[model samples]
Target: MSSSNKIQKKTKSIDATKKLAEKIKKQALLKQKELQKSSNQDADADADNSTTHTALSKATSTSPVSSTVDPDAQLKFNTFAELKLVPDLLEAIQQLKYTKPTPIQSEAIPYALEGKDIIGLAVTGSGKTAAFAIPILQSLWHAQTPYFGLILAPTRELAFQIKETFDALGSTMGLRSVCIVGGMDMMDQARDLMRKPHIIVATPGRIMDHLEHTKGFNLKNMKYLVMDEADRLLDMDFGPVLDKILKVIPAKRTTYLFSATMTNKIEKLQRASLNNPVKVSVSTKYQTADNLIQSMMLVNDGYKNTILIHLLNEFMGKSTIVFTRTVAHAQRTALLARILGFNAVPLHGQLSQAQRLGSLNKFKSGTVNILVATDVAARGLDIPSVDLVINYDVPTDSKSYIHRVGRTARAGRSGKSISLITQYDLEMYLRIEQALDKKLPKEDKPAREILDALHIHVDKATAEAIRQTKEIHDKRGNGRRRKNYDDDREEK
Candidate 1:
């Protein structure tokens, strides 16, 4: 073909694509209006008999008002039923035994159902996932369109967890959702995308890869965009990638930005992405759950490992996570735990995607009762029944400390966190206490004779673990090992 003919052909294709996108958007809008009409009719029919419907009607009467829902805000809707969720969602919630909405859920869901942009600020494990998932699924139920929602998570683990939530909640609705994350095969993900799922839960980096490299996949007509863990996403320098994604997706879509803390970067992101969003904050500052029992153990650096073993022994047969600051620490700690006869595993970013998932499954399924993890496991992961969180290494910052401990004591469950405070960690620990506005009480030390006796076994285990780790590193070769063994900093 001649140059002019080729140019004209390309232009025609572009025009056709735009027109198709417009058609899809119109159809989605029309379906949504119909769903709204049906919902209103149902509400009117049951309003006299349903106090829940009356409350929901009053809550959503305004045009997506912008206001903060404090932790103590009188909850407008207590139960999922009172939130006026569709019967399908209500049934799923009932099956899941979710009797009442968490504060964040009760505050955010009603506005989200009203098609409003939202800035949801809540700590980890406050039912933030369900807060956003319920509304998105409800919208998907009404519209039934492919690629109806796109949820961006910070880590691959979080992406998969979010997909699981969507699948479970939308089970009765026959929901088709795919998780697009790194560490999995690209071709497999491409095939999943070809299936045209209703929701795409993904980490920003991998999703951006698909958007750029994968043919026949895009989010141009996606109706809902949820940036879960917005602060962590920005902290990982996903702002540039998020900007690119925001450019491609339709601006008319509803957006929900949920974060633990609203930093300057998050505020900037909100301004750039959300439009007149209602800000719902369940907790205004850095705080752990009230149900969490936090204490500190002052230890000498030489005996830190022994103290860790001592605590693990006390909490034996219970689900616990040991938080380390480095990949090597996590690996060696898990090895040490196993040497001393603890059912333990390690999870960090250094492991291949398969290994990471395997470790998580082992911990989640009770195959392993202990997980030694880096900061990677601290945020946005919903691991239930964590009886204790042990801070093997004091987190570098208060925010990180909060997230690490947040892994336990979730959803009103009682849990405990013990931080090992060395002389070096005292300054950092004090900063954390200042951030929380309360000093943590000192944990009673075990009898000296017990610790002295335990030290012998721990020292032997430590020596064996170090030797094994060194051998493994040597086999991998120094240069390659160094390249791959960086701390668990970025998700993928």
Candidate 2:
């Protein structure tokens, strides 16, 4: 009986040990999840809380006369609903699921609805599209006025997006907006123009082509002029063409300029193009979307690839867009990433239109997880949700950075922008920060120990490199490592 009791006690001891091991494993998993939550770039830590009112709602709160010398002076808006939009327009807004007005809406819509000139400094996706789009629809509603509204966009992609937004809002109304942009069907656009659309959303180059090629293209009744991305347009050589178009346009017409940033170029164009106009900006300083958390990484040219590899190892499964400075850089980065077994793709202007569209569609659908792109594909792109924007190359200037980072942190969703700065980019980095007027936090390189923990597999060449590096360090005996493994191996 004593022996049997002793055996039972030993068995119980084994059982307790097993239970303790299981408990420890579960605890480790929970801690890992917590660590991941803390480390994720887009951890739902912030969101865009600034879009108070949609365009018309935003517009109505402003005073007609300047209350102060500052253009940002607050104006009184009774409400955007006071703009007296057609019932069908309201229904369309409701169908699009917009319940209330944006700030720009409250301020600009009332004046615009009254057929007054306006200036809008709202950010992209701040419902600026709808701010002008709604007014355009309201102004053209049941009007006998010719050439309903003329709105110019900076990029073909943006032109198409604006037309799409309009289509959704005008589904119930008797209005049609034709898109005129580069790279697709000019003759077809000429044919579209023959229909005499109440509104024309066009890129400058294509519109100029239509003006040069198509006869009887009169702006006799063109009552409204809108520059969707005013700053970008004036920044490009589109200035001369736009200036000429403005000359042909009816001088007495009302005008509106909407841009993410109002650069000096925009100011020059505004003075040249817009009369005493109403201006509104969401924030005094142009920033990454309110929801985006921006950080910076410093690397040498040779280290960029290894750092990116390490980042991917850590960020496993998240969608990321890396913005390179040129098409060749985009192509090379995409290929290198793919060769490294990353789900990567290249999207740039160098591809045929079909190819560009195809790559975008694949990335959007999650077939390809990472996209290396130039600014051409970056504008007016609204993916379902972008997890990160990496400036593989720091932008030429702050405006470029704004547009690139704007690719993420859209609507009310959260995102992040990481600038990869190489030694060569030092000067450009300072300029970018100077333009931004905000200091970027420098993040330490990710923990290499974590890479080992995750069992990351590097190329044979890379592995050989790491081995040689450790050997040299071990020889130096700087005490970073625990011991000189090479010496130990030799003694063995």
Candidate 3:
């Protein structure tokens, strides 16, 4: 054929390819629209109004419910009974005393059970673990497979918490879950893996370590991949580790990505991890829960400690989490609270894994009612007993503020959060308010009167707490240096 004839043929082939591409895009969009419409329909029929739930108002005096119900009111699930969950799981839910589903659970569980990819955007303490755990358990109830699901979390504590949830919900089914995280015994984790467990709850780095080194262990047959607290995972610089896991996992598996906030990194992760996902965003705005009563108290430059002490005394015997900006601050504040006769514990990255877990367990078990910590405990662990969260130190940003306050007001429970703001925290406080799109309520009581009621004296207790904090800090620093020296010598 002539050159002109060949050119005409190539151009016609190009046109055909373009037409096919357009058709595929149109089909995908239509499918998305259909899924969205169905989701809207689900929302219309099954939605639960958590803000107005009786559970949240049992003790508050004449608490008024929001007059406006979301237009998607029909999509909420009022109770666990309405979810069509398996009988065993429902029994477990009842045993756990979960009468109603939080918004995230109400919305995400249905789609997850259908084996669709999902991106659940909810605040911390929004019952996201159950949203994924229920469906995974329901799928694995009768599966003879060794590992049916893989749930990834940013921190070991979060991973362990997920594992506990899985164990509780699947207890009747005799299902098992193995936790893979750093700082734990690798051989023990390997032994657990050898048991042919049905679920694997792990952190990204440790999971990669096991996948690369552990013999005869793989997730090739895994059916579901869940990245809980996905935003914090990426923010912690686990992107490369996540990529490695994705490459090894089966391409046919369903995925559920849950996060408290959305960022550029989270969006990219969603694109890389999910396929045709249904986005379930219960919290589009960077705001705390409707059940959370947030307030801020302005303090003089040197009076934050005094205010914090007063507040802790005011909320004595209640489950409270006190967030400090630094590990040293957490330690000092916790020691001070202890000296003040409050049952307090400290949680920070500086502690050993066992100690961190022990601290958390103590807080959860009510052995210790006050938990002092840095941002490490801010994101994903749910403690329903936390009725109050005191920002001993104001958060550095809006995202931190959201997560910090989220430690309370969990699972549709009414809770209160107060931030101690000084002149230095004013700028960050303003940014937080702007991010939340509303001004926090100011404390109604006068500062002098509040302090007078508490009658706190900081002379001896404060000095001793500061001294204890310094001693602990020095020991940790020295231990780290010793480890480094030992490692260097071994390499030689």
Candidate number achieving the greatest lDDT relative to the actual structure: 1
TM-score of each: 0.84, 0.73, 0.80
lDDT to native, each model: 0.88, 0.73, 0.82
| Per-structure clash totals for the candidates | 0, 31, 13
Expressed as tens digits, the lDDT of each residue in 1-492 for candidate 2 is 699999999999999999999999999999998888887634443322234335556677554443112324444444444556788888888788776566566666777777677767655445678888887887677674557788898765667778888888888887777988665666787888988887888877778778778977877788888887777777766778888788888888889887777777866776687776766656444655667888999886766766777776566788899898976578767766776788988886545445676888789899988988988765666674788888988887877888788877776688888889999999999998887788899978866675454334444434554555455445645552233222111111
Between prediction 1 and prediction 3, the one with superior TM-score is 1
- In TM-score terms, candidate 2 sits at 0.73
lDDT of 3 by residue, 337-410 (tens): 88988899999777777889999999999989999998889878878778999998898888988988888887
Give the poorly placed runs of model 2, Cα more than 4 Å off: 1-83, 144-146, 364-367, 449-492
The lDDT of model 3 is 0.82
Order the candidates by TM-score, highest first — what do you get?
A: 1, 3, 2
Clashing residue pairs found in predicted model 1:
none
